[model samples]
Each structure stands twice: as C-alpha cells, then as structure tokens.
Target: MTTVPAVSPAPSAAPAAGSPAEAAAPRRRRFPAWLAVVPLLAFTALSFGVPALAMLNGAFTAKDPSGGASHYTTANMTASLGGAYLTALTGSVKLSAVSAVIAAVLGLLLGQAVVTSRHQTLREAVLTASGVLANFGGVPLAFAFVATLGNAGVLTTHLHLADHGWSLYSFWGLVITYLYFLIPLMVLTVVPALDGLRAQWREAAQNNGATTFQYWRHVALPVLTPSLLGGFVLLFGSAFAAYATAAAMVGSSVPLVTLQIADAISGNVLIGQENVALALSLDMVLVAGLVMAVYLPLQRRSARWLD
Candidate 1:
C-alpha cells in the first residue's frame, strides 16, 4: 500500500454554466429550421381571409336586386334574424345537439368494441362499413331511407303501417337521417382516441385492486374528455352545414337553415331574394362561427395532450 504515492484526486470537470462558450451556445428555435411557411401564409390570407372579409362587408351593405346602389346598414342583419329564420336556426341547433349526443354515445360503445374485441377482421369490416355510410349522405342516403321507410316502400306497405305511415319529409325523419351519418362519424372520431389508450395503465390499475369503474373514472374519462368535446363539435358542424341530405329528405316540409337558405336564393321568393339570400348565408356563418369559437380552443388543448 505504501509502494506508490497517493495519486492526487482527479480535477473535477467544470460545470457547463462555468464555461463562457458553453453558456453562450445558441438555443435552437422550436420551429423547424427548413420549413418555408410564407406560401401557406399567403394562400390562407388570399383564400380564407379575403373571402371572409368580403362576406362580412356584404353582410353590412344593403344591395337591392332593383339595381340600386349599395349602402351599409343593419337592416339586412335584422331581417336575417326574423321569426322563420330564428325557428330554423333553433331547429338546427337543437337537432344537432341531439344528434351529437346520440352519435357520441353510440360511437364510444362502437369504438370500445373495435379496440377491445378479439375479432379484428369483423371489427375492421364494420369500421370500413361505418366510414362508407358516414360519407354516404346527400341524395343517395335520402333515397335509400325513403325506399326503405316511405309509405310506398316495402317495409311500410307490407307491414301494414299505413295508418302510421312515416313521412320522409318531416323533422323526425331528418333527425333519423342525420343519425345515420352522425353515428358513424362519432365512431371514426373516437376510435383513434380509444386505441391510443395504454394497456399498461389498465393492467396497473387492475394490479392495484381498482375496479373497472374506478379505472375509467380515474383515468380513461379524463383522457377522453377532449376527444368527446371535439367529436361533438364535428357532428354539430356536419349537421349544420349539410344541405343536400336535408334538402332531399325534408324537401321544404321542414325549414332548416340550409333549406331556408336555399329557398331564399332560388325558391321563387320575390321579396329581397338576393339580399335575403345573402342574409341567410350570413346567418349560417354566424352559427358555424359559434361552433368554431368553441372548437379551436378544444383543438389546441387536445394538441398539447398529444405533444
């Protein structure tokens, strides 16, 4: 032990903050180094911003179909919110709200089945079918529903339900039609969120003697809140913007926003047709804008969760 002199303790490495060069190292920017966003910015400004601004301006300006000069006023907006328009607007919001609830509940169950089932093939097939049906709205879906449930259709006539014949041109019928698309949409929106759940968490919860409800309450539900809200917004927007489906299904019996808008434009309404049409479009924009106001923040928060 005494054969060699004790070696001096190795000098400790200098701390990073102690070195000027290390301390002065430039931090990398969070954004990508190679991305060129100027084109995207320009495109958005031209395509979306310009059109939106123009629409807002047109909403304020009064233009008569008689070739009179345009003047800014609140008359158009006030007329746009008339009783009929208000009724349609309320109908749309209420129907959409109901559809969203129905779709989300059914969709969550479907998503759970798809994710947890052992029969992957069957689940995949069902998912594919749901997707196809979700996009299969417009005139085609209306025809399909009419052919199945209309008075002259096979089911209605053969089953002797003539006394209680279901009219395709009714609000209830529209709700059913909307559900057809909305349910599948919910399945698609929610499946990914369910699939993203970690098996390990469930296992850990079980190992710790947690019940099924406890696991869902403490873990799954919180994680799913964002997706649930986002899906509701998506369903509402889809139902709100839908024109062809509602047009074909109801065919002027029920005055939805889209239906009213269509009538104002080309339904032979001689009174302020162009201006009223513009007003209808503006009304739809306001409703859509309200949904978007809720949508954007939910989307941003969801993105943070993913990150």
Candidate 2:
C-alpha cells in the first residue's frame, strides 16, 4: 500500500534573450489620429477660450490705472443688471423671442415644404439660397434693406408702405429684418431633421390604420420637437448677439443689448465704460450659454433617433 512519491515537476524555462518573444519589442503606442487636430485645438483655445476667460476675469475685476485687472467685485454685474442696461437686455430678449418664434414657425413650414417636395432641383435651390441668406448679415444686408426701405428710398417713395404701415427702422421692423437671417438659419437647422425622418414610420402608421394627421401629430411631431426647439434657441441666441444690422439700421432706436454694448465701448466718455461693455458682453455670453445648454441636450436627443 505504499505509493511512490509523485515526481516533482520541472521548473519552467526562462525565455532566451534573443528569442522571438524578446525580439518583438512592445508594439510602440502609435499616436492617435485625433492628435492631428492639436493645432486646431490650440487655435480654438487661443481664439475663443482665452478671450472668454479674459472676459470672465474682466467682468469680475475693476480696471486698474495701468490697464490690467484689479480686485474682484460684483459692481459690474450690478451695474449691468440695472438702469438702461437692464432695459436694453429686456428689449433684446423680447426681440430675440419674437423673431425666433416667427422664424421657427416660418422656417419649419419652409423646411418641411422643401423636404416633402417632389422636385429635387427645388430642394437644392431652396437649401442653397437658405445657406447664403443665413450668412447674409452685418453691413451688407443692412445696406440692402436700407436701400430698398430707407427714408426717401425706392419702396418708401414708390409704394408708400410707410404711408400705409411699415417702417424698417423700428422695433417691429428690426424683427422683420432679423427674420431675414433667422428664418433661413432655422431652415438650415431644421431641414436635416426633416430629412432624417424615416419613411418607415409613416408606412407603419398607415399600416396601423393611422391617418396622415394622426401620424404627424403622434409620431412626427414628437420626433421633430427637439430639433425645432433647439433651432429656436439657437436663433434666439443669434438674434440676441447680433450687433451689426441693428447698429446700422435701427441704431440707438432699438436700444438692444448689442447696440448698448457698442455705445458703452465707443459712445461713453465716462470712465470704466469699457469694463461696462465687457460686463454687457458677459451678460450676453451667459444668456447665449444658457440657450446652448438647452439646445445641446435637445440636439443630443434628436440625434439619438435621427442618427
């Protein structure tokens, strides 16, 4: 009954120094393809990131006599939140809201029309025109509107719509002008969403005995809502931040946040107005950021279904 002791196993051999395993150097970690974007990242940081940080810094700090940041304070925010500045901000928000709503409705209609159209050429033309017109801003669009609608101008003298009920330099008029760009921008923004709407959904709805109206009301509208709302918010930010055409056509007649910013930077003889301008800019940035905060989530939600 005595069993032989089990033989001990030999120890594993160490690899030879020049063996294939040793010769194979650890695969060098190749740089990621995204590293090629480093220059672009650096450029963006220098452009938007640095300037925004400086603006944030200046917004909280008083200007020194030596033209640099001083001690931090809330005076800038207070001043910005009060008086004509407050009025300007309120007016800008109203304008942006009104225009954005109008643009969203009109752009949605136009975008849907283009998307549902039978003619490919018409869709291409519509999109091309929208793309161009969305960017048609600053001095040129202002000048174009002025030439057609200014005092003693063509339409002003010929049609006499002013004699009826139209002035392109007033608040409502500014809304109309803002619509020129806003509507097209909305078109561009919403068009993709419209196009992404799957035909299968419509077919499924029909197969389930759903009418066109029911299909749209239940399925399409819900799907489109995020994209629509996101675009509206984006349009709001655009209108809120616009300085050029307002300055050119309406000038101080509007008293918009953007125009106020310009006046603070250039028109004021008082000390520290520059800081005030920066503060105003800060206010605008905050509002725009808020709008974007809303837009980003909606955009993400939309992408989930669309993509």
The best candidate by TM-score is: 2
Model 1: CA > 4 A from native: 1-35, 64-67, 162-165, 295-307
TM-score of each: 0.80, 0.83
Q: Summing lDDT over every window of 10 consecutive residues in candidate 2, give the lowest-scoring window.
A: 267-276
**Per-residue accuracy of model 1 over 172-213 as CA lDDT, tens digit each:** 778888889889999999989998889998999999999999
Off by over 4 Å in 2: 1-27, 31-40, 63-69, 296-307
Q: Which candidate is the best by lDDT?
A: 2
Distance from true position, residue 256, model 1, in Å?
0.6
Work out candidate 1's RMSD over C-alphas: 7.9
For candidate 1, the 10 contiguous residues with the lowest summed lDDT are 267-276
